[model samples]
Target: MASDSYDFIIVGGGTAGLAVAARLSEDPSQRVLVLEAGHDAHSDPRIKTPASWLSLLGTDVDWNFRSEPQPLLDDRVISLNQGKVLGGSSATNAQVFVPPATAVVDHWENTLGNASWNWETLRPYFAKAYTSPPVDGTMAETLGIDGWTETSTTHGPVRTAFPGDQSHPIRKIWADTFRATGHYMAKDPFVGSTVGSFTALASVDPATGERSHSAAAYYYPIKTRENLHVITNATVEKVSLNRHGLNHVTAKATGVLYHCGDEIKEVTCEKEVILAAGALQSPKILELSGIGNADLLRQHEIDPIIDLPGVGENLYDHIMCSISFAAVDELETLDAIFRQEPDALEDAAKRYAKDGSGPFSSMGVYSYAYLPVLKHASPEGRQKLIELLEEARPTKGDTPEHARAQAYYEIAKASLLDPKQPSCAYLAFIAQFVGAFESNTKSFTISAMHSQPLSRGSVHIQSKSVATAPKLDPKYLSNPLDLEIFAANLLQIETIIRTSPLSTLIKQPIVHRDPASNLTDLDSAKNWIRKNGDSMWHYGGSCAMLAREMNGVVDEKLKVYGVENLRVVDASAIPIISTANIQATVYAFAERAADLIKESHGLKAAGA
Candidate 1:
């Protein structure tokens, strides 16, 4: 049985939850409790080994939630994978540690009307969240990693390192190919603007070659602290709130009701209850607590506490589709080592066990390119995209909640179409074929990911039961503009494959489409996307942080509107998805949120 009370009870012991818990527990007087739905994965080999990430996809460590059949994709149900372990998706995701573009952060500040949320104010937290190793001789100085260490009282918990010296020969070829095709080579992608092609860093320690996630970096370091308590395998049912007399509009969360093993329990918090569950589950928790649409709550036989309809409305995620090619016999992919050669695999494992430097230590993705639509789209293609954006407006019957989502889509479309904006399309090259590794063939994949999507979806509780999964409708490629952008980006990827250095090593296309067939026709490319596209697993915006008039679930400070002592500090509060991977941004957001909470409670802030 866990303790009956604490100062702060954080629901969901994932990436954001652990970061907030670590910071809040810095003051020994504050009693902090974190409830995790999954067990502690400290010794799990599948999670510790970077190359073993794919094996954990359908296992118990994964939430393995499936999206509702997407209408745009011939009603195919796409898999939505999220980490259920202590570190959340950070423990399960590819260890790419890239930050968002400056423009994306600027959008959160200007569009959300929060002057303090810009990149400049949040820049310090990015430095505070991770301790980065030098990429090259001068990189530590250029990125100010040394400066951050010298100035700050406490060094960051998470460790960031390069992909090691043994990068595959194909990596350089891909980088050179992008430069030859007229894309600027990014000097360092971590310095705010990620506009060009560059080598990506991962969240791994170079010395030990083990995965560096929130659990290993943040929670475990302070687990023995008397004020910090963590409950594993506990599922939070609902947040228990106390309402003011006769005023349903005002309420304060006092405790949480959850189930641990065979017993149901209740834990009270004297100060606050923070919801750090990811996008899908966070909104479902709110709806279960009667804080969503009044009609939806009444339908579930739960009394409405707040009539905020934006609780689960504005859903956004990156959509990705891959174009795979068979690799030449001279080139060795990760798949070839495991499938063909047994003794070599044993030797590699021995090497990793002895020194932690081998194929098993890396994620196999070395270089990536971010391209704006203007870089690839023709004049006619650009005009077509504008027309598509203009036609994609809110319907007259859309509710206030949905209208707010439509307004955000307009802003996103404008940013994507703006030539000056950093990028809307991401092209990533993996050294191995992702889904078809079981086949007895050596292959590599080029995944074209659309960063800025206009389509919106929702995740709502179908019943008043936390045991049941929520209905998730990502509505991928629902907007014609998304398909249009994907088609243009696919052409750009093919151009890179056809360019000099990479083309010499390339073979025929394996899965997506015939390499010989010309995809110049827009409709043919769009059809191909509908059949092959899926989510990139970067989900957010179900509980966005915007003004109440914009149908926001939480305010700028991450406090849930109309409710006191209740806040959501996770990816769910992100209004717009960032241009790069979201884990770094999530960490930064948690770091800043901890400061805000400390200020409100009159507690001394961490790193003050």
Candidate 2:
């Protein structure tokens, strides 16, 4: 039987949880316990297959959380589905493994009050978490695969690949399209700044073409370790803390209270209680554990332990809007597969079953461009953005709550004006994004996402029960600047689609699934964004790691305020959301966090 006491009690055996558990338990003398609310789903084909990722949504392993009707988005209730299974969203996501902007990571330290959290310090952690695939031809060039990045540090478990044969004509078309416009990638995206067009890697193993997630990469290898114990179907209710510390200002974590099946169990943590239940649930856990705003806690009849008002505030996401353009009949898009053509389905199944190398090998999102406002927006649009920035600048000494907002506001302004910082991204998914049901019509999608939205929202619990879902309000497009940027980037699709090589592939009298998306004007584009914007599902900043006054829950080392032995090792602690898909950043953040934990306790891993 597993003991009731462990050196570390990790709640939420998802992405970061598994990484920390595996790394911490590297010391055979230290016993680590991981409690997950989901089951062992590694055997599920939907999780293992890269193309079956979308099928995993709304299933038993999905949390299937939705936002509370965004008023700015015409009161649309956006779906914010997160993974409830062992691997978490990493297993269920589109598998696009892209990194954040170099400027953004540097801001984590220079602007966000985090010491030694710059890109220079965290780059190795990214190298330590993923094993890169082999390089070849123009495929390697588009990927910016340099010599050093292909070194021995990439021996980490999470497998990543370029996905499929790179000989597809679309690859060259994409590079040529961007290169003609002087926006081709300047350097390797992995080690430095990424501000232009490049191919994105996916979290799929090249050897087997299966989904490479934390459960498989970090957890499975250590599952047999005597010191590591992972318990599934365990939902944590709260963290028990001891307030008898010096001056009573700090509360030391004692244990964790969780529900396993029908029984409520208590497990003691000899060292620390780490919360890795994702951004949506991590703050709620803290609120339930009596570490939230005093007024709100008492309203729910729960006693306050820390009175940290920042437990569930400052929530934001990349507001994404997609426009699917009809492609020429000659260009073979994935419309047949999405439309479920009998032949296409049979062929895809056969190809995947054969050797995992085919059209079904990866999500068709090879080409991506992280562009600044200069590349797309007209002179008028540029002026409008500048005016909006000045107009929305927080007034002098406006309020304490606006301090962090103001700080972020300055960065957004700098990022927008600076050519090096990309304000939005255009993801090339070679299929109809929303309406791909027309078997006769071949199409491709250009999904524009606002990288650094100034708009902020909140996620607070309704009641004290764990079953009661928190109110998620991303408050998307709340900032006027956000809409301007969204419109600017949205305008770039037509510009690129009209460019040579790529233009030849598009059918005449171009049709969009949403008729409103056919307009070319900036005003109409902004309207489209307000009415059609949805989350990229990159949620963060709820439990931020900033100063306490800036509505932060954790510090530089990720320790919760007023709690000595409590920490959050997930997206909940990420102060700034990454410029692209945040899975890479999440993996790197967890890797660095494990080192921080080791440093604090004077413990070293077996290999280290």
Candidate 3:
């Protein structure tokens, strides 16, 4: 018998868990319990200010999990920074608002068993999760007001702009020059299309200056709700289940076993148990519950209740690399200026605190472009990505039907990228990508991001012990084709920097590091990038949603397989990686999952 129990027990009080709790608790009747492995929310200055938040890295709030050494890139140990606190990565991420592409939604409908996941159906949830700040005259017409995550670019007094010359003598030059060169502007990066540069950002309120996180934007508003119990510093060890009579494999879940500091406790759930522990940890929780890969579990001396083989496979991430240039002068750049003049940093901080407008606005990462690397990519690159997706699709079997699926994918690709359409620069940083630039006379920086590469990896249970960290491999740039395309993309970026518009302002040349030894090279900078690239800190796709018996831990409805009442609602539920920042999309997933949970129970809507 359990000492205590609730209607739903949610594990991991980070971005997804909190969102689930917040949405379900709307009724004030249904009880939801959230367990966090980290500390209670704090008023730390570093967390409150967006610019200074980077200082939180490697601190108590960060999970700071380093991956096993990469066999490809000089065996470098990649650092995977996950949020250890209530807000999860949202508290630690740069707060970029790149929404999932519409085509991604279509793909979800086709892959996942539920067709209700299409863009039109999911759009409302996306709108409800955010609250957008007011945009100025010209920008107002461009941005979306319907989003639920509450994004705003209306800079407040204390919020600082990206640290460079907005009026750079070259910004207008580049914008006009790019237009003349025939590049089209992508309207809103989160909606319908994403292929051009538009003004980018989620501006914080000047009156508050503090960045709004999941805790603030979603959970804090309903923190005092009587039905919601949020437990921090409580690590869920495993979920406990009770078997129904023989042959009824769909057993009833009674409760979950978790650790509070060193004490083990069981909290039963009357209705359901949600593993909202994000991508990497969610599958691990299911495995701990004895609900995955039977052979692997038997080896670990644990009884296997479920035979799901896809518990901890299909991991993927975007790896980023960049060119760092020598700044011409201290005043013209943010890093150098702040370093050279302590007063400037102090002044910026003071303004943000006093007025919320200074240098605290999202560090200038606006401007972006999605360029395709493969123009009829080779059969090799498609093999890994296609095989994984096929394994997750439910069209019958690996029979003739499955083989025909390849044609559909090619058609989708041709529709999106028309080669006959004159080849424009396949690289860009105009909106939402370059982030705040330093002063004109200082250092120059341009980053290259892998938008939607065909590389997949994995995160698996190394041991059954709760104290051991799960083994993670991002498999970054694993495919030779991905390497070739990404390398070529790097060269394009180098071309823009070396061209007339940007070259005139260039101080020192950008050095490329060798992939094998991490050494710099004057020639073949592209080669170095392929060999030495690392993640952009975006980690997900583990325990992804798909049809049952189709290599999925969760259903299209986000419910876990073989478990009577378990669901995963976070970045981990994403079947395929989105082409942008994942925070906003995760919030949307939470919002929708909450409604689904409510509907499943035949419960009245929260407000109702």
Best by TM-score: 2
Residue 444 in candidate 1, Cα distance off native in Å: 2.7
Q: Please list the residue runs of candidate 3 whose C-alpha ends up more than 4 Å from where it truly belongs after superposition.
A: 1-3, 111-114, 138-177, 245-248, 326-332, 337-341, 373-441, 498-526
Candidate 2 clashes: the total is 0
A best-first ranking of the candidates according to their TM-score comes to 2, 1, 3
For model 2, residues 77-171, the per-residue Cα lDDT tens digits are 99998999998889889999888889998888988889988999999999999997876654554443332232333778799987865656676
Candidate 3 C-alpha lDDT tens digits along 548-592: 545767786777777788788888877766666677678777888
* Local accuracy by lDDT, each model: 0.78, 0.85, 0.63
TM-scores of the candidates are 0.92, 0.96, 0.83
Pick by lDDT: which candidate is best? 2
Q: What's the CA error at residue 222 for candidate 3, in Å? A: 1.2
Better of 1 and 3 by TM-score: 1
For candidate 1, lDDT tens digit of each residue in 233-314?
Answer: 9999999988874656789999999998889999999999999999989999999998998999999998898888899988
lDDT of 3 at 132: 47
